[model samples]
Target: MPVSLVILAAGQGTRMNSDLPKVLHQVAAAPLLHHAMQAGLSLDPEKLVVVTGHGAEAVAKAARAYDARCDTVMQAEQLGTGHAVAQAMPLLAGMAGDCFVLYGDTPFIRPETLEAMLAARARHAVVVLGFEARDPGRYGRLIAEGEALQRIVEFKDATDEERAITLCNSGVICADTAVLADLVSAIGNSNAAGEYYLTDIVEIARKRGLSAGVVICDEAETLGVNTRAQLAEAEAAFQARARAEALDNGVTLTAPETVFFALDTHVGRDAIIGPNVIFGPGVTIESGAEILAFCHLTGCHVSRGATVGPFARLRPGAELAEDVHVGNFVEIKNAILDEGVKVGHLTYLGDADVGEHTNIGAGTVTCNYDGVNKHRTKIGKRAFIGSDTMLVAPVTVGDGAMTGSGSVITENVPAEAVALGRAKQVTKPGLAPKLFDMYKAAKAKRQKDQA
Candidate 1:
């Protein structure tokens, strides 16, 4: 059977205390809502609908970034879960397959858990994701009869015994599209909150003689971020899972807890990651690559056997070929370092192409931008860039060419040529003491004048 997904992102999240929408806040270097969307993408749903309310435009934009095929609906009012989901009804109208409802604020949901819910739909009309919470507290209780879920009772409305139930509703529900639409339509605002609750659909299904089921998942999978503190907690949880996964996949992490990974970071087996490394979006480390401590990489690829710094930054468009060495305090952006290239510490290589086996010395810089225009620098194979050399943009260093130390190169250097851009050396002998005596006489005359 085909499946679709409806993501609810209509909450105000006033507790977050920021102008940005709550769902837009990042966990593991990605928007929380994006994480939810990624989990759903694994299922290859036919239709993905994101319902936005607070910060509607921004939230919708973020949603589309993850899945361009995503359709968005607006919930103009902050009513309740049922009302929020109903906003997507028009899009779900003609579909008869299973439709899963996910929360944008709850981003740790796993694909396997969603698959379990969809699987249970084969035997039940409604399937609700639940968790055995250590402290159920105010969460809605999931009343189950064997594998069948009898009802969902909110804590405030439940009796003492019901409230004690540890199997709590995680607010993730899946049902046939038509059944979900019908059940949500029938839910009324008759409770103390005067809001239509999606949980009511469970009892409504039971009343219609439709069997309901529950798929139990980890409580951590249902964590919702409503404040800064919760966001931090979510980030920590995401890191723990990502680190463990990296280790399980045969990658090495020197200090697992200190490293952070983005949503799309990919590290092949045998890659080594040091402590305090942060991977932003679109980073890939091939097998045998070593990334040292305190490095940050984003939108870059480290090829096999490449080594990156203890304090390097790889910005967007940076690519390191096999055996490339990018030392500490180096930053590479919009550049490609070919195989066997060695770039030592304290250098900036941007908008440049460095050929194979090129050795770039410390304090070297490719002046790529001038006022408004950005230019490129090409360093041919085996080229040597001396320390403190500034290779002005639109310049090229041919194969086997070398530049003198502290040289300011504004033009090309031919193949195998040595480019010396510094001024002629000159010295004045026996002048230091004479200059000091003159300075002392002047100082003495000035002091007498002042007295």
Candidate 2:
């Protein structure tokens, strides 16, 4: 049977107090809603529907960044949970499989729990995924009798006894696709919140003699964010999990808590990550590579045995080959450094390629952007670019070539040749001191006349 996931992202999230949709807030370098989509993807749903409201345009834009062909369902009016799911019904018009509904704000939900619920789903309908909470004060109460659930009583409607019940609801359930469509239609928006809740279907199912099964999961897996504080907590949780995974993969982090990993970063075995490193998406570090403290890498690759900065920045399209050393204050973007390359202190190499065993000296900069367009600077093998040199692109330094310090190379240098382009040095002794004394003597004369 096919499975279609209906992700609810239509809520305005007033509690977040920001114009940007709460789902777009990042956790581990990706949006929270995108993380929820990953959980949905894990189940391999046949189709996906993202219901959008509030910032509909922005939400739809974010959906484009995720996998699966997403159809945006417009919830023009902020009615209720049932209404939000109802808007997605048109997207699932011809679908015959189970329709799995999930909240976008619930980013930490584990795929294992969803798989468990699917496994427990029955032939026609099954309202599953619940747990006995240690503190169920704010959650809806789950009233189960024997092997079946009686009803999930909302907190507002529940009496004192039901309110004290420890068995709480997770609000994540799967049912027959057609049966769910009909059940959602029957839910009326006559409750305290004036919103037609999907949870009402649980009680309606019990009344119709349909069995409501229960599948329990760790409560932590169901945590959702509604405010900035909650967002911070979610970020901390995600980072913690990411660090733990990196450690388990044979990557040694000096201070795991100080290291931040993106959701899709790949680290090879025996790689060492120093403290306070921030890894953005698409970053991959090969085995035996060492990244020193305060390094920020985004969409880049570090080859085996390569050593990156104590303070280096590697932007998108940056690739460092084996045994490459990018020392402190080196920023590389859209550049490739071949094996045994050493790009030492304070350099910027963007849209360029540095050859094998090349020594790029301190403060050397490849001025790639010439006001209007970006140009490439190519350096051949064993080339030596001297300290404080500026290669104004589009320029090339040939194999075994050497450049003098403080030189500004406008033209390409031939193989085995030396290039030096700088202002001629001249000395003027005593002139500087004579000028200073003249100014001081004038000031003294003026002060004496005034007295």
Candidate 3:
């Protein structure tokens, strides 16, 4: 069955005490809204809509950045969740599928949980996600018998008996797109809060002889961030889960708690990640790759058998092929190091390509930026770049070439050639002591004048 998602992101989150929209706040290095959208995206939804209010433009941009096909609608007023869903119905008009109402602040909803709700749609007209809360607190209570959910009672409007129910609503619902649009249209805001509640759809559907069901998930999966403290807790929760999953999948984390993972970090089996390694968005380490402690990697790929530093940064577009070794204090950006490339300490290879088995000595730099435009440096196979060698931009060292130490290479070196672009040393006899004597005389004169 085709699926569609309507994510509610219109809340101001005043408790968060920030001008940024609540859903734009990050967890796992990605906006909270992206997490919700990622779960929905796993279902390959036919249509995706985000209802935005506070910081609508920023939120809409973030949504489209994640999925360009996503459509965003403006919710000018903070009416309620039902009103928020209503705003997206027009965008989803004539779409035939199960429409899921998701909360942007809830970032822990698993894809399997949503699939379960879709499966439950086989027997009921509406399926609401419910959790057995450890502390129900102010959450709406789910009134259900077995798998059949009778109605949902808001804590503000619930009787004392209903308030005592431990099963709480998670604000995640799935129903037929047409049926959801109709149910939302029929909802009214006459209750305690005088807000149109999406929960009310249950009672309205039940009264119309349509059945409603509950799909239960872990209490942790229903965590919603509303405040600064809750945001911290959410971040911790995401890290804990990510670390555990990495360990379970055969990836080695020397210190799991100290390693923080972004939303889209992918490490293959047998890969070793040392302590305090932070993975930013779009990093992938293939099997047997070793990332040492204190290495921060973002938007880079480390191939099999590649080893990165104890203190190194791989910025966007940095790619290391199999068996490449990048040592400490090395920064690579917009560069590719082919197989068997050894780039040791104190090197910056940006906008360059090093061929297989090439050795880059310490303090070697590809001066890629010429103050106005960036250029490329290409080092062919088996080349040797001597220490402190500066390969100026738009230069190439050919196969089996060797560069002299402290050389500044401005032109290309042909295959099997040696390039040396430094001035020859000249010997000076008895010049050091004479210069020191003159310096001492000048110092004495300056001291006498000051007196």
- Scored by lDDT, the top model is 3
Candidate 3 residue spans exceeding 4 A from truth:
430-451
User: lDDT values of the candidates?
Assistant: 0.95, 0.88, 0.97
Query: How high is the lDDT of residue 210 in model 2?
Result: 81
Minimum summed lDDT over a 10-residue window in model 3 is located at 77-86
On residues 271-371, what C-alpha lDDT tens digit does candidate 2 reach at each position? 99999999998899999999999999999999999999989999999999999999999999999999999998899999999899999999999999978
Residue 75 in model 2: lDDT? 94
Give candidate 2 regions above 4 Å deviation.
122-124, 427-451
TM for every model, in the order presented, reads 0.96, 0.92, 0.96
What's the number of clashes in each of the models?
0, 0, 0
lDDT of 1 by residue, 1-451 (tens): 7888999998889999999989999998899999999998889999999999999999999998888899999999988999999999999889868899999999999999999988898899999999999998899999998789999988878999998889999999999999999999999998878888999999999999999999999899999899999999999999999999999999999999899999899999999999999999999999999999999999999999999998999999999999999999999999999999999899999999999999999999999999999999999999999999999999999999999999999999999999999889889999999999999999999999999
lDDT of 2: 0.88
